[model samples]
Target: MRGFGDLEAEIMDRLWSWGRAATAREIVDDLQLRRPLAYTTVTTVADILHTKGWLRREKVGRAWVYEPTCTREAYTAQLMHQALETTSDRAGALLHFVDRMSGDEASALRAALEQVKERDTP
Candidate 1:
């Protein structure tokens, strides 16, 4: 239910954006373009992410390749849900959230709600 740390977020962002499994070395290399990072540091954080169930990994040759267990969108939803849970008035919080949405985002939310409503109708 908790969010990722700085390096953890960096690693997850790379894997999600890449849309494929990647070894820690590949992540480290990509991160190096933005800032210096050690391979071992990335590997250790990746292992932590795996343990935390945010990532799935498999041994490929001598390295462990990692991929996200959920999409970035799913993660965003979970964080939003968690934020709502922290408020005493969920409805009020949601109203505030809706009020801040742009026109396109509001339209998408309405469309998604309609789909859910149609699916739930019995």
Candidate 2:
């Protein structure tokens, strides 16, 4: 969240969702909001992702196929860790975050945790 741009987020989502390597054109095709972007733009973004250590690339034929280096959950956890590193008041920031979530969101989180616990225990 913190280290990503709009395009980066979109591209990462596409790569992670596919769970496979993809070229820039392949990434562009998955975008729902169709916009005229040159192939260079996508390549540049993919390169930037690689530079940021969020993506890994492999040359395939004439194109470089890119894939996410980390899972979505791992990336999110890293972002949270970065946030904590930046904040002096970690407890206060966490309290504020919990305060902002709606009751339904809290319940959903609890349910997800319970499911994970059940799976882990049994």
Candidate 3:
């Protein structure tokens, strides 16, 4: 899928951070604290997100409640995969990334790898 526009990204951020289905009014209210935005603007963006398949909404009390179709982590993983695809030497790039990880992150990666190995052992 294509990346989001600035306003669209902000709208998604609000949905992911809110961690619940929310009406356009709620998103607009949250965003308004940073700057002014009209309710229709938010509503339009939410509808656009729904059309893009990034959000799904249901009608509730004459208003549409929107929520992300994918979790932030899932989106993040897709972006990371996309980044890796740009490199000619994927393995070398991944290795370099691993080499730069903090100690705790490295430990977690090692533990995750071990779990995968165990699962594959039958």
lDDT of 2 by residue, 1-122 (tens): 46788888889988988899998888877673577667787789899999988999999898899989999989987887888878899999988877999999789878988999999995
Instruction: Give the Cα-based TM-score of candidate 1 against the true structure.
Output: 0.96
TM-score of 3: 0.86
- Return model 3's CA RMSD, one decimal: 1.8
lDDT values of the candidates?
A: 0.94, 0.86, 0.93
lDDT assessment of candidate 1:
0.94
- Please give the lDDT score at residue 110 for candidate 3: 94
Candidate 3 structure lDDT: 0.93
Residue 81 of model 2 has an lDDT of 86
Check candidate 3 and list the clashing pairs: none
State the lDDT at 87 in candidate 2. Answer: 86
In the range 1-122, model 1's lDDT, one tens digit per residue, is 88889999999999989999998889999999999887888888999999999999999899998999999999999999999999899999999999999999999999999999999999
Predicted model with the maximum TM-score: 1
